[model samples]
Target: MPNNRSAAEISECIRCGTCCKKGGPSLHHEDTVLIEKGLILSKYLFTIREGEMSYDNVTGQLIPASSDIIKIKGRKGSLTCVFFNEPESACTIYDKRPLECRILECWDTREIERVYAKTRLTRKHLVSTIAGLWDLIDDHQARCSYEKINRLLKMLGGDNKDDALKEILEMIQYDTQIREMTVQKGGLDPDIVDFLFGRPIKETIGMYGFKLKKQGDAYRLITIPTGQNL
Candidate 1:
């Protein structure tokens, strides 16, 4: 059943703050200028890399990301957009907000949905030109990719469990080491690691219902019982 309603019929934003509170909007190629112009700093953003599990706002469920989803970072200890001033019910960057934010009409989401996943901006698009930096990001993506991690998880409980565990642990170790080294030696902002590498592998692996525990300088993967992920 199709209900006909023009976008113009939808009421304008009332500053309810629901959209900003839900989470920050994913950045698209069109929004790159905002970052280039320094209107949005790197520390204010993070990336959900390709194949990573991410919450889909429209579907209200976690789905594997199809590509890098660069997004504004949330305030500390909350998922609310950092740019959102809750007390004032206004976006600090309202005038220069991303495409999604400008097109989104909570009452009529048709326009936002049409361009939601197109022309997504990834770390490569933003940082690929920098010497030495892009190399590290590319290597990290290749070695610690969720694609490889998912494949390894499937091999667990099979005869290849031992081999799978070794590889998974190694990837997690590399992910951690590189982040620390990049922050210490590369002089990058500590918070920017999430943007460059898309969250620590050790942490995101929990999306598979597994976690790592350090045991005398070594790590062990443990299966979290159902309903215990909270």
Candidate 2:
């Protein structure tokens, strides 16, 4: 890749919205001004929980990532950036966009990757008023962490397999119930539940070699090969 480009070279971008089409930019601590000004609402953000797997742009590899990252939520069922205006091929909040969006250059990724490496804005920084919610998150996470769930699966074998599976299912259900109840009692938006509790039970459990199959209002566990890497 070219190390440098002139203004004319950078002006090659046609505003086709292809980059934003891929996904929304993750917010940095510097972008808190936009959030505080209501340009970026809490409802518009979601958390990427610690230990969740994601593609690292800097490393160009899929890695078990850490950090409770706050990212702009994408449109439902789509990867497109929430601020992207499809008809105009422009950003809806271009004037007050996240730092990543402002510095991104399709021609050279050095700037964006540098910003990406910095500490991200977390829920604690954005919603400090709701310290209780953070406490609830910690409680739920300790009880139903991926490490605990994975360990439970690893212990499965022999005649105790059925009993172990039942325990895993119950743990998942219990975790789901806590998340739902948190939203109901804490007055948090239902849309942000996944952010608080990490991904859905099925997806999180899938990281530990289990898949959920829905059957007539019930879920069945199916063990798939995961290399037991977790």
Candidate 3:
């Protein structure tokens, strides 16, 4: 609701911390100093995969469109920014906060959007510090690319239909196992793992017009009626 106003009116802030309570700010290139100074740890941040649906802050809509956002970790089991001290209603690292935080004005969002459109911190930027982690992510993505899965699904219905379906299901199970082993060995955080690998194998399969049902340790595919949208 901020509009053209005097400097004093623009400076007015209630310090309610409502904005911080909603979610953590995305880090930008300008905020790298905070990480370099050790005020913010890489482990305390996570990435949102490209193509994933997320809020469009500039438009103020919950649209399924967003870039690979790197944001500070929120409190365990809540969306509140980790730096937010609930009782105190203040940011713990206010001075060294991310660029988005430093530029935000509750009364006006123009400054924030201008900064957001420039540069943002991404997984690639952190690759040098965590090369092995990035390698693992690349390996996993190569193995489970959606295009590969879609091709496998399309190969169905020619001959030996049942056998082909069984093979696809087994491949999915194998992919899941590989992800589990990688995460276990890498000791990467679970949130990071989920973001990198995306939804479970069964849910992903569903996106291709097939429903996966879990039976004990195995899986079964249930095809939807023909002509139904995938």
Clashes of each: 0, 0, 0
Best by lDDT: 1
Q: What is the lDDT of candidate 3?
A: 0.69
Candidate 1 per-residue lDDT, tens place, 78-134, comes to: 889999998788899999999999999898889988899889999989999998999
- Candidate 1 has its poorest 10 consecutive residues by lDDT at 1-10
Model 2 misplaced stretches (Cα beyond 4 Å): 1-12, 156-167, 207-209, 215-218, 224-230
What do the candidate models score in CA lDDT, each in turn? Answer: 0.90, 0.76, 0.69
Q: What lDDT would candidate 1 get against the real structure?
A: 0.90
Instruction: Please give the lDDT score at residue 74 for candidate 1.
Output: 90
For model 3, how does the per-residue alpha-carbon lDDT over 1-115 read when each residue is reduced to its tens digit? 3234654575555667778887898888887778778898766676655543445678776443244567887888788998998888788998888888887887887888888
lDDT of 2 by residue, 15-84 (tens): 7676798888888889999988988887777777666666576788766657767788889889898889
**Off by more than 4 A, model 1:** 1-10
Top model number, TM-score: 1
The CA lDDT at 218 in model 3 is 69
| Residue 108 displacement in candidate 1 (angstroms) | 0.3
